[model samples]
Target: MIKIAAMGDNVVDCYLSKGTMFPGGNCLNVSVFIRRFGGVSAYIGAIGQDEAGSVIEKALHDENVDLARLRILKGATAYCVIGHRDADRVFVRADLGVSMFSPSSEDIAFLKDFAAVHIGQSSGLDDHVSAAAAQTLLSYDFSTRRDPEHRRTIAPLCFLASISGGDLSHDEALAIAAELRDCGARWVLVTRGSEGAILLGAEGLFEVAASPADLVDTLGAGDTFIARTLFGLIAGETPHALLSAAAVAAAETCRYFGAVGHGAPIKLSGVVPELQTISS
Candidate 1:
């Protein structure tokens, strides 16, 4: 079995229009998705002492994701207030809350036992990337951070790097993928939304069309792709097979309401002032 650790960032996505919230954040979603794929996964991040934190804890526990490294801090949990426009999610407000944290030496020691560690752009662990990569394969989600210099700096340190190119044209996506590969990322996956995805690796470029879905929400689809693809790589699957499977998993995620589907009624009064003021 592939065992991995997801370090950094956790948030509750609040859909104010629908008065519902879901546990999300790239690292958190990846950990949950890995477990759903039958891999052993652990989450390492901080959360607040509020209801939002409780909600996240419950969902992670229910999914059987290891929370041995989870921290319950004394502030509000990180959150993003979302609004929908023709079914696409739009962020209206956001707060980092207690989510920004660096892994300690002991945490890094524990992470070395895993097959890989997954982190994202929002995960405040950029300084620790080199150290962590030295001990285990590191999977990074660059999301929409497409600065060439930034990619050049971090790509060489990542075993597998994923980027969100959904907004870019086919040529643009291919260009960025090639750049990341040239910068030394052993494997690179570029997701282009409806245009499907492209993977660049040792064998060369491989493209796969996006799988069909009912399309309820597109929030966690990319994260699903990243998590599944990473797991398949560790399991020794071919690039074509893994990307194809990942596209299907991503489509499945689109059929749900939240990142991993544990939705709860939004309690504005219990959240931070920024969230509470929005409802009023």
Candidate 2:
């Protein structure tokens, strides 16, 4: 069976103000969503043999995501200190640790079992995996990175590119997606937190209003959206159907303090998904 891959970087998120910690990263969160939505999912990334890394590994294990390609090195694990409120957030500090992340030949060889790959924000990792997974559909989260040269490098590689508009107005969000389209994005998307999301494709722009969520920690909301979008694409769903599912999945993530179904005890309501059983 074809599995989907979410690989690149992950970090142990330290909620300094809240005195809590959790495994969090774009790719990791994407994997979390895949497993919950009943898709065969794989996570490919590097981690150290530290306590924090142990927690991350355990978390992934709990999610039932395949970790055969996970690299455990000998050093401190990547970590980030975050400060967030009921409605906002701030990154206090971060360290990438000793992880040198890039897909190995063995990892690429494993992609034959997968149908799609979601590229996270690691430049080096992207450099390696994008070309290797050439046969698979590729999607990316732009992460509010507006640097022209950087966007140029990543844009062409994406079948769909998601850009964060945070709280931008309708016109503002459209502008961001347009810029990405100009930079060669085949499908451009702008995610606007609780407001909704906007998409720019061959048929022009479409908007998906945010699904209702009792707001919790907003950390993994965007990541969940990326994962949902990937799964929808692999399912051969239309863009309108895909974005609607993505919006629901993302808002569902917001109802809890972390990404859903990574042992979150959150039940997915609304639409029923029909993917394969999650991989162990």
Candidate 3:
């Protein structure tokens, strides 16, 4: 099994389907999907000590995830209030009372056994922790930056990058990809919801289009896509395989109501038909 370690925030996704709470967050969601797809995975992050945190921990256990490293801090969990208009979700975010930050060298050391270390883009700000974790890092942060210092900070650590379209412009995305490469990243992937994904890998630039589907909540689709993409690459699958699997995962996620559901494993056979390959 390919051991994978994910480090980032654990969010209590409150999906307002006539005002209801739901589970979500990048690390937790990705860990769930990675395990479902046969990767040995662990999540290193902090949560709250509230009832919401309890629910999240239980869900992780029920998902058969290893909870040895999940630290529950005394505060309200980080959350997003999601409003659904038709099938799309609009988010109201709150970062208050979440776990305080700490850079864990031990967590970094533990991730060395894993093939890849995935850090949520938000966690990229925790450069010390991310830089200590692994030589090969995949960052899910896609904020288009105008600051050169921020670019310098992120450039050295990430090997591969995943960003949403809303996070960058076409030209800006290309520039960001190049900047990340200059900073040390080997590949950069920009995700455009419904349109597809753009990749800057070893061979060069390529675009992978999204599979057609009835859109639901696009909550954790990016996280799910990134997890599966890494899984395929770890499995020795080709770029086509990685892109296909990622697309399928994203599509499956959009069929659900929250980020947690995006991690459901779809068979390789199930994704092949809906995928489209692009030129490098």
Candidate 4:
């Protein structure tokens, strides 16, 4: 089994339109998604030991995600109240002290045992949680700065870095990707939302269009896409397989409100029909 570990922000995502609360944060979502698809995933992140935290923890356990690395504090769990309409969601988040914990020495050692590790800059990085994984696949965020510690550690690792068009222009995105190649990542995938995503790989640049969908809430779609695509990569599935699976997962996310909607139930088998390979 390919052991996957994901570390990042953990939040109680409350969806106003759906009138529901779900556990989220890019790392938590990826970990749960991977576990649901038959991979062993360890979810490592911090949460405040409050009602919100309890709910989030139970949700993860219900999803069958291993939470041995989950950290709970006396403070309130990080939270986001999301309001959504068709294809767009606005978020109001709380930044508590819980975001300051990076993977401990034990956490780092544990992660090295996995086949791959995924970290997200959901809140951007500060001194604490930035670059927590030293020896695994990184999902780089262009909106977040690379932790100096992580940058040095990942210089020899294989990984993917991405930025939203909201964060960069096409030219700037391309330049930043090359910079990542210089710093460490083996590949860069610049996602331009409706414009689609561009993959800069050893095989050269591959750009693909967004799969068709009735846009509901774009929240969590990017995270879902990256999680499923990485699963395909680890499963030795074809590039086409990865693209399709990710597209389906992302499309599913848009059918409901908030980051995870009813779409969170998707498995690898369900995504095959939704995928179409674009010209490379």
Candidate achieving the largest lDDT: 1
lDDT of each: 0.91, 0.73, 0.67, 0.65
Ranking by TM-score: 1, 2, 3, 4
Error of 2 at 131 (Å): 1.6
Reference-based TM-score, model 3:
0.84
Which residue pairs overlap in candidate 1's backbone? none
Ranking by lDDT: 1, 2, 3, 4
Worst 10 residues of 3 by lDDT: 271-280
lDDT of 1 by residue, 149-248 (tens): 8899899998899999889998998898888899999999999888899999988899999999888889999999999999999999998999999999
> Which candidate comes out best when scored by TM-score?
1
Candidate 4 regions exceeding 4 Å error are: 123-133, 143-158, 166-171, 261-280
Error of 1 at 206 (Å): 0.7
Can you write out model 3's per-residue Cα lDDT over 99-128, one digit (the tens) per residue? Answer: 445646676676666777776656533555
> Of the candidates numbered 1 and 4, which has the greater lDDT value?
1
Reference-based TM-score, model 4 = 0.80
Q: How many steric overlaps are in each model, in order?
A: 0, 0, 2, 1
How would you encode candidate 4's per-residue C-alpha lDDT over 15-97 as one tens digit per residue? 54444566677777788778866789998888876666767788888887788888887665666666654568766444443
